[model samples]
Target chain A: MRRALKVIVLGVWLLITLFPLYWIIVTSLKPKAEIFTLPIKYWPGNVTFEHYADLFSFADFGAYLLNSLLVSLVAAAGVTVIGVLGGYTLARFSFPGRGALMLAFLVTQMLPLFIALGPLYLLMSDLDLLNRLAGLMLVYVAMLVPFSTIIMRGFYERVPVALEEAAQVDGASRIVAMVRVVIPVMLPGIAATFIFAFVQCWNELFLAITFIDSEDAKTIPVAMNSFITQYDIDWGSMAAATVVSVLPTLVLFAAIRRYIVEGLTAGAVKG
Target chain B: MRPAFTLRKARFIALCLLPGVVFVVLFTYYPMIRGMVIAFQRYNLFDITSTPFVGLENFRAVLAEDRFWTALRNTGTWVAVSLFFQFFLGFGLALLLRRHFRGRGLYQAWVFFPWAMSGFLIGLLWRWMFNGQFGVINDLLLRTGIIDQRIGFLATPGWAMTSVIVANVWYGVTFFAIMIMAALQSVPKELYEAADVDGASKLRQFWHVTLPHIRPTLALIVLLRIIWILNFPDLIYSMTGGGPAGSTDIITTFLIQQVIGGDYGRGGAVGLLILGLLLAFSVFYMNATRFEKAR
Candidate 1:
């Protein structure tokens, strides 16, 4: 009885958890009429790729995808570089205002992005960066770098100082030691930080919508919202667009999920 | 006592730190100060030439509006109900996942996928699911004989808030589950073993051994989750745009609406209110939990 109950509960939770994902994918593949049919079809009768083709062909979906890619890639890379340096310094060094710097990062993490929205818009406009991918990149980097630095700090904290000291004793320069020994050791943590930063940039919506206005510069989320706000939505194509938007993050997530979980636990549990 | 700071070390640290500091100050700190200043001015995005200082007029105007109170109440409901359900269901799910089982890794991945997606996209996905005319949810309920007629989950004011809360709960469950599960794993086995040897029941063992071990994690997660849920408006914004007469409108959405409508002064006023609320909450939470003392 106990064993059966466990199995049943787990199965129910699984169905509930996975159903939305399943439903969206199915909706994307279904014919338009079938999507709105009463007593909705649990499974698509005729699997079709018409919506996917339409998204790529008639819509500005290709530009949106490219824009998302360019913005997220540059922002994620910049955050990782900054995060690694700042994280390492905080983890391994003692300097004037180190405590203040750490507190500042924490404060930034807790701040509501809405607080910055109105002024940031004005600032971006003043700089003539409105509707530009570069402006969005700057905002994303600021939003993500603080959290990434904290995650990177956790990674560096786990590494013992002895390793770096041993390298220095062997006559290696500090920079050379970090590159040869510390970097290799911290590769998994760096990978985890990179994936986390990349996914955040890929998934951000509010700022993207606010900052990017032109059709050519819009990211997937904003473009998807445009489809939503319209009077008549092509449901199938919209669902397909949703799938395309989430696919990259989902792939990156699956590949390094274990590391991501570990990174999170390390950051929080230790505190 | 501190380690001696050498010249080369300071130089290296400065080099590493300069870029990140500059970016943060320009984008984060500068905008924060500017947002505060904008709150005191009669600023309108549509009219850039007349942003003169207006003292407390904007704050008074925002606070006087009935919509502000409605949004405040809705925000409280949204955060409280969502957090309550997310905490319990998430903890339960974590316990279930803790037991080793077949295909558990895949199950974990599937369950946590929602947390990986954008909140706005999640909102859109749930909006489609709760569609008044063609939603899968209504279809399932009808097919199962739960309701004789279709229900407008998002169109009805009473249900709109519930619908968005449901979506928020679903999106947040994985966060609590992941954190609690990690804490659960790190609980030493010896405590359970000792309890069993001492003639304690399973419930007692759990109460004594498990709860205490995860309390800190629980406290921290709860604090962070509250702040996150309060600041989050994307899911609700995309789902209903706080529609059906603003029943689902939260403070964040209200502020966003003001900004979108080109009223910068009112939006900045609400923004400052949110910041003040968050600051107060953080101070209270730190005192209640004694988190700072622990640190």
Candidate 2:
């Protein structure tokens, strides 16, 4: 009896947690007329792919997708590469201001992103970078690099220093030694950091909205904002867009959910 | 170690660190300093040529506004109420999930999915659900005879803050659950056994054994989350645009509004105010927890 109750409670909680996502999927499939009907349809009566079809024909969603892909990929990859090098340095070597550097990285994590908003806008505009993908990429790299560095450092701390020393004793240079010894061992950490950075860049809206105004440069999040205005809400198209936009993140997250959790734990509690 | 060798090692390390450091300084620190400078100027977007030092005029003006005070009060409510419910519900859910069960992995994945979702998207989802005319919430409530009329969850000042907080709590619970569950699982099973030997009840065991072990993680996460919650305006922004009557407006969204209005000076002032609050909170938190000394 007790076991049954536990299962039922957890099942109810799961339903509550997933109801919004389920609703979006259901709403996306419903015919347009059923959407705003007084009695909300629990399930779609006439299922159709018309909304998804409309998104492609009428919107520049393709461009937004490409921009999002380009920005997220570049920013994530840049952050990971920089993070790995910096993480290794912090982990392996004792240097001047090392303590301060570590503290600064932590402080960066706590600092509100908007602290740099106005100035960065001015700077980007002055350099003719406003409404540019490259501008967004630069800002994202700065925002994410600190967190990625800390995660990378946590993983590096777990690897024994002896392995790197052994590689060096075999006449390998420091950089080469890290490449041969540390990279393979830290691949999981690297992947985790990449996904974390990628998801962050993908989900970012405030910065993207602020920086990119052109149709060619808009990302998925910013592009979706057009559906929502004071007058009208294109519910069907919006739902379709949401599902499309969140699909990559959901898939990537499910694939490496454990790593994401572990990375967060390390970054949050252990760091 | 020889002096030459130590120097070379330092140089190599510095070389490795240089790119990351330069990026951070140029992008993060540089912009922050610039933002501070902009707080004292009339940096309008359209008429940048006439920009001149304004000497605390922006600060005074922003502070003098009625919306600023409303946003401040709403921010306090948003953070405090959201944190209260998230902590309890999250802790409860974590405890429930801690026990090994069938399909726990699947349950865990779905339960944690909301945290992976973007705040704006979550806001959109909730907005649809809470739509007064055709909302799932009202449909369910009406069907169940809970209410005769639909509540405008996002349309009224009284309910808008609650509505947004509900969404925030849903999105944030998974974070607390994930962290707390990890902390819980790490507590040695032997502590429970000892508590059992002491003739403690299940609740007592939780209070005396589980609570003490997880206190540090709990405290730290709460501190960090307070800062995060304050900075997080995305969900609130999308839902009501801080809505019906500026009822749901928080400082972050208020600052964003100023920028969107082409009032960079005022926006920068609000940003500085937020920065100051966060810095003060961090110092107080660290001292209260003796976080630095513990290290």
Candidate 3:
């Protein structure tokens, strides 16, 4: 009896968790006439690809997708590379001001980026960077570098220092030792850090909406927000766009699910 | 080591670290300092050429608005209520998922999926779900014979905050479950076995063994979540835009409106106040936790 009750509870929670995602997917595929039926159709009677087609043809969603992809990818790569170098420095050496730098990074993680919005906007406009993709990419890189560097530092600390020492003993310089020996072993960590940063940049909406007003420079989240604010929200197209927007993050997260708990808790748990 | 070799190593370290430091300082710290300065100036977007020092005029203007106090009260309710539900429900979830079961890995991934979604998108999803005319929620309620007629969840002031809190609870439970589960796993198996040998009931064992073991983590995560919930305005922004007479407006959303409305000085003042609020809470939290540890 206890076992049965446990199973039933789990099953009910599972349904509650997945029902919204399932509903959105179903809504996206349903015919327009069938969506707002009196007694909401639990299943779409006639599935249609019309909404997905409309996203491409009428909505100009392709540009937003490309923009999101470019910014997320470039920023993820930039943050990961910088994180590796910075992580390595913090892990391997104890230099002047290192402690203060590390504390500053931790403090930055706790700060709400909304606090910087007003001045950031003014500064970006002064630099002629508003409504530009490159500008958005720079902000993302800065925002992510601190957390990614901390995760990377945790990863670097796990690898024994003796391996690099052995390489240096074999007539390899410190730089070469890092490039050839340490980096090869840290590939998985690097990938996890990159995916974490990528998802953050991909899902960012506030800064994107603040800086990029031009339709051409808008990212996926910005496009979706604009769609929501329209006079008559096309529910079908909105659902379709949401599905497309969420696919990349969901896939990337699944790939790195194992590292997520560790990566997220490393700073807080240790402190 | 030789002086030349030490010098070369120091240069290499600096080379590795410079880019990260420069980017952080230029983007994060610089804007924050400038934002603080802007709070004291008459920094209007309409007349940016002459932004003179105003000596707390911006602060006075922001404080004079009744909307600011409403937002502050709503922020307290939003954070406290959301945190209460999220912690208990998530703790239950963590307990339920602790025991081994078939397909557990897959189940965990599926349940934790909401944490991977954007807050703005989650807001949009809940907004549509709560729609009175064609919403799934009303449909479910009617079919279940719970309500006689449809009710607008977002269009009404009273229901809007409740609706958003429900969505937040749905989204945030996964995070607590994940973090708490990790903390639970760190408790050694031997400790549980010893508790069982001592004739402890499940409830007693939980109180004595599990609670004590994870208290620090629980305290820290709760504090972190409090700060995060207060700062998070994306869901409220996209869901109701603090609608139905600004009933659901939180401090962060209020600040966003100030910025979007072209009053950077007021926005900057709001931003500084948020910073001050968070810093004050953090200091209080740290001291309380330290006192607990000492006891």
lDDT of each: 0.86, 0.86, 0.88
lDDT of 1 at B94: 94
Q: What is the TM-score of chain A alone in each candidate?
A: 0.95, 0.95, 0.96
Per-residue alpha-carbon lDDT of candidate 1 for residues A1-271, written as tens digits (9 for 90 to 100):
9889878987898788888888989999999888878768989999999999999899888988899899988998998899888888888898889999988877877767787788899999999999999999998888877777878887888998889888988999988888888988999888878887788778788888888879889988888888888987778998898899888888888888878666554333211
Which wins on lDDT, candidate 1 or candidate 3? 3
- List, residue by residue over A1-271, the lDDT tens digit for candidate 3: 9889888988888898888899889999998998878889989999999999999999889999999999999999999999999999899887778899998888777777776887888889989999999999999998887888889888899989999889999999988999999999999899999998898899999889889979899999999888877878889998999889988888888888888786667433211
Ranking by TM-score: 3, 1, 2
Flag regions of model 3 displaced more than 4 Å: A266-271, B1-5
Q: Per-residue lDDT of B1-295 in model 2, one digit per residue for the tens?
A: 3134377788888888888888888888898888888999988887888989989998999999999999999999999999998998889789889988778998898888886788899999999888888889888989999998999888888888888999999988888888899889889999999989999999999987988788887888898788888888889888889898899999999998888777889988998898898888778987887764365
Clashes of each: 0, 0, 0
Clashing pairs in 2: none
**Candidate 2 overall Cα lDDT vs. reference?**
0.86
RMSD per model, one decimal: 2.4, 2.5, 2.2
| Candidate 3 C-alpha error for residue B209, in Å | 1.6
What is chain B's TM-score across the candidates, in the order shown?
Answer: 0.95, 0.93, 0.96
Listed in order, each prediction's TM-score against the native is 0.96, 0.96, 0.97
